[model samples]
Target: MTIHSISARRANRSAEARVADQGWRELASELNNHGCAVMEKLLSPEECAGIAALYPHEEHFRSHVHMARHGFGKGEYRYFRYPLPDLIGALRTALYPRLAEVANDWNERLGLAQRYPADHAAFLKQCHDNGQTRPTPLLLQYGPGDFNCLHQDLYGDLAFPLQVAILLSEPGRDFTGGEFVLTEQRPRMQSRAEVVPLTQGDAVVFAVHNRPVQGTKGHYRVNLRHGVSRLRSGMRHTVGIIFHDAK
Candidate 1:
């Protein structure tokens, strides 16, 4: 789609529309069965390219992290500054309410008392009130030999439970073998690993730390972590939309 059309779509809240078309029932089912769900082509190639291009411009980001330097992994990423780009801001707002529904259900099933608000702005205000005022959305870049370590994206005590990452570069064409990976650690059971498939513009909405799993006895909390596998060749870029802020 052209930049003009993309702008028109965002202006008309197309993010919400497309997400609705994905069917909240089915999306929640997928999230409950697995720990993640893919929203196909949530962004256009042009839009992905535009966001990826912003990585080199430091003005758009507040902090840069070399993963290896922190013993996290081999890749690097930049945290977006306040006043996020138009598309990022729009998607964050549009996606939250739908995900919040699933999050609330999960919280109840897990016996957690925390409940998310119906609106993204209200939830964000709660985060800020708890001293998590810094933005958590980030852009990640990886090349050959680069990979992200298995970890959770918890920034503060006020975590939103779910987060999203949109692939900005095409597999095979733009890069290869840098797959999205998730691991589930259940009580007294063997851990399971899943490699999520994605193409350019695809977004995966996933659990950040914990999710409830149904057992014969009852619902139990399972630990979850996500990361990227090693890149074989070329380059990769992704934009992550994490709802909660950091200190």
Candidate 2:
């Protein structure tokens, strides 16, 4: 099917059904209460299989392996560097439309269209203002035994708080080692962290910065320092979608 068809189908999904399927309201409530929210089983098994099939293990091993700091200790971890093939196919065909819908929905929720219109306009203008620049999609893959360091997704002045990951592997079957962890606060006395063990078709939504609330002083903050734990079992696979350039 065409990308347009996929997007139309995704969009035609009733809001109530989407909420029921993804627990979107609960997630939104969690985000309101905290800085992040996790929704389980956001995608179907068939969709997960389709995404997984897009990335062959042999091909991934040949092209996307790399080393990065896995934890605070001396040792490093193996990571799949780029899984763009499947992601590109998904983006051009399926992901963007869903992402756009999410973006629009979130924009409405946060009233970002009114608050950050100038910033958004300026950013988009800057992207288009430059003659040689063309907006590009970023795709990063992770596999078993691989891990990423705790860091924010910020590059220069162009940064966005929202990000999405499409899970491609089965929870217990594919690989069991990589778990996405997020720190709630950093360098604070009462700081805490949470490890989100997500299954196929699940996604995590989080804020990159804290918005000030009336009663609390920095009580609700966005701690975007996130990383993955080492993969120990079967190989884990995921495709990340980001709007800004990966530096």
Best-fitting candidate, scored by TM-score: 1
User: lDDT, candidate 1, residue 97?
Assistant: 92
Query: What's the C-alpha lDDT at position 101 in model 1?
Result: 92
Best by lDDT: 1
Off by over 4 Å in 1: 1-12
Q: Which residues of candidate 2, in runs, are more than 4 Å off?
A: 1-24, 56-114, 117-140, 209-222, 245-247
> If scored against the real structure, what TM-score would every candidate get?
0.95, 0.62
The lDDT, on a scale of 0 to 1, for candidate 2 is 0.51
Pairs with steric clashes in candidate 1:
none
| Model 1 Cα shift for residue 46 (angstroms) | 0.6
TM-score of 2: 0.62
lDDT of each residue in 1-247, candidate 1, tens digit only: 9986678566448667766787678778989999999989988899899999999999999999999999989999999998888788878988999999999999999888989999999999999999999999999999999999999999898999999999999999999899999999998989899999999999999999989999999899999999999999999999999999998
